[model samples]
Target chain A: AQSVTQPDIHITVSEGASLELRCNYSYGATPYLFWYVQSPGQGLQLLLKYFSGDTLVQGIKGFEAEFKRSQSSFNLRKPSVHWSDAAEYFCAVGARLEGSQGNLIFGKGTKLSVKP
Target chain B: SQTIHQWPATLVQPVGSPLSLECTVEGTSNPNLYWYRQAAGRGLQLLFYSVGIGQISSEVPQNLSASRPQDRQFILSSKKLLLSDSGFYLCAWSSRVHEQYFGPGTRLTVT
Candidate 1:
């Protein structure tokens, strides 16, 4: 079965410190990978997506994720953490077939906490 | 640019009452729509999806049902609400590329 795993349930990082969140996926095919961030009580916002071509994809809010096919991982990283970046992050994977319905499998999510 | 809208940004309902949440997309046509629920400290779970009018696919077997009466509209309904249904409900839309755009979400509290 296809699934996404975000090993870290929560992570704490001081403001201005570099951050990295790990994600691993089990998929049968070349999958479409995505990262989304959700603020408390708010909807999810797309952080970045990896469809094809480049292994490293840049997203909004100064976040970037790299797709490592061999490791079956797409880890999100940022050079410096901001206090506002304290949110839950999710990793998702979906089929890459053309015209396929957007049925994505998401990980349990990792909550990031930024310390002052 | 495509935009997704989900409303009654917040809902507080008694258990055993009926429930209805609406979602609509603008600037796109015949897009794939999805309903997902995010419980406390958990990731989003896919509930339902629609590829077109009157075409609905359920991913989970639960008390919820979904309808797509129109191309751009999707509704999630339950004949009776359950306390387990209290969570953040999100509506999303996606095109051929399959990257979904989510709405502001509805926070449902079952009391």
Candidate 2:
């Protein structure tokens, strides 16, 4: 049923403070959002995507995201927090339902802690 | 400029051993291959995908199985191994939409 919801599984900021990580989606029509980052053994890294127009999307290290389609939401931002930007952040959803072969439906990540 | 390669980066077996994990993709062509699993820290679970050469598509069902004889090779098999099938095994590739390109993962430990 196309789902993605990352409601902060763990977050703690304080190194210049400023970060917002929350993503929500249910998909039915226009949706192909993504944001990934993993740095422990590394494997995922593609921090920005929102296919359509402009709703604020900029990624790669400094990170930035915003695609609010009537609040279906796609939020991930970073203003300052940096302790090497503690990793583990994912939010993905790409639906091709009937045509298939286009997979990506993930969410269950968000573990950031930067305090120093 | 595309690249994806997964191997035995780290593997430890013991229970009914019999498994293979190998994925390769270099620059692109009929590309769309995937096999993901991350059960230690969790997230990314899409067992298999292949859109050519032999056509295989499965999204999690059990003791692994995947193959794409050519076009950039992709193989993940298991004839007996299962200890809940270890964890952290990723290999990905894409050519459009939502972007996907990953590989530098393979940490299977079963016992």
Clash totals in order: 0, 0
Q: Per-residue CA lDDT of candidate 2, range A13-114, in tens? A: 998889999999898877788898888887988888888789999988888999998989899998998899898899998875566567888898998989
What is candidate 1's lDDT per residue for A1-116, written digit by digit as tens?
88899999999999999999999999888799999998888888899999899999999999999999999999999999999999999999989777678788899999999999
Per-candidate DockQ values are 0.80, 0.24
Q: What TM-score would each prediction reach against the true structure? A: 0.97, 0.35
Extract clashing residue pairs from model 2.
none
Q: What is the lDDT for A112 in model 1?
A: 97
Per-residue lDDT of B16 in model 2? 88
lDDT of 2 at A49: 88
Off by over 4 Å in 2: A1-18, A21-28, A32-35, A45-67, A71-73, A77-85, A88-91, A104-113, B1-6, B10-53, B56-73, B76-111
Model 1: lDDT equals: 0.93
